[model samples]
Target: MVTDEDKVFKALADASRRQLLDKLRKKNGLTLGELCADHAMSRQAVTKHLVLLEAANLVVTVKQGREKLHYLNPVPINEIYMCWIGQFEQKRLQALHNLKQSLKENDHEQ
Candidate 1:
């Protein structure tokens, strides 16, 4: 089963999509034309990338007047960090703590 996390990872795997996300990060809300302005990709290509981003819930659209504004949603990325990356950090921290304790013990015995 393709999970929501899987979708996020897949969407983020592309460099173009990452660039789009970076653009949104720099400026919270942007229209399709704005995103395509300085980018190498065609407007249509950008639209396709945005579709994938939207599917992953990495990008959200808000209709302001006649323009559709795209915004980056940080929640999915934060969830990934908390669930996947944070667990590995805990193990590394524990190892460092153990090493510190071992060094202290050695110093006391010397």
Candidate 2:
């Protein structure tokens, strides 16, 4: 069982791993070699990143003949957003709106 926090932070920990996720998000179902070509890291490093992503369930791999293609599994990411950002979005927006209204009132008073 993968916890939301574990998946979210682990997936976001490494810049290179984030880049790999971005690439997969844009053009999913890419082979390991295809992903490696886009970055400067060696194949082994990319594989390590992929392992982390996979462990987090942030990525899924499929075998197509001789190649294993990787795809971004967005469910975990969305879960994180809902757990973290969704909880605060309404309050944050209300605070911003209140601040704007206060500023407007102050400007009119001046």
The candidate maximizing lDDT is 1
Q: Assess each prediction's global lDDT (C-alpha) against the native.
A: 0.92, 0.87
RMSD of candidate 1 to true structure, Å: 9.8
Top candidate on TM-score is 1
Query: Model 1, 1-110: lDDT tens per residue?
Result: 32478899999999999999999999989999999998999999999999999999999999999999999998889988788678768888889989999999999999
> With candidate 2 superimposed using the best TM-score fit, by how many Å does residue 25's alpha carbon deviate from the native?
1.3
Judge candidate 1 at residue 45 and give its lDDT.
97
Minimal lDDT window, size 10, model 1: 1-10
Candidate 2 per-residue lDDT over residues 1-110, each given as its tens digit = 66556766867888999999999988999999899995899999999989989988888999999999999988877876787678658798879999999999999999
Q: For candidate 1, what is the lDDT?
A: 0.92
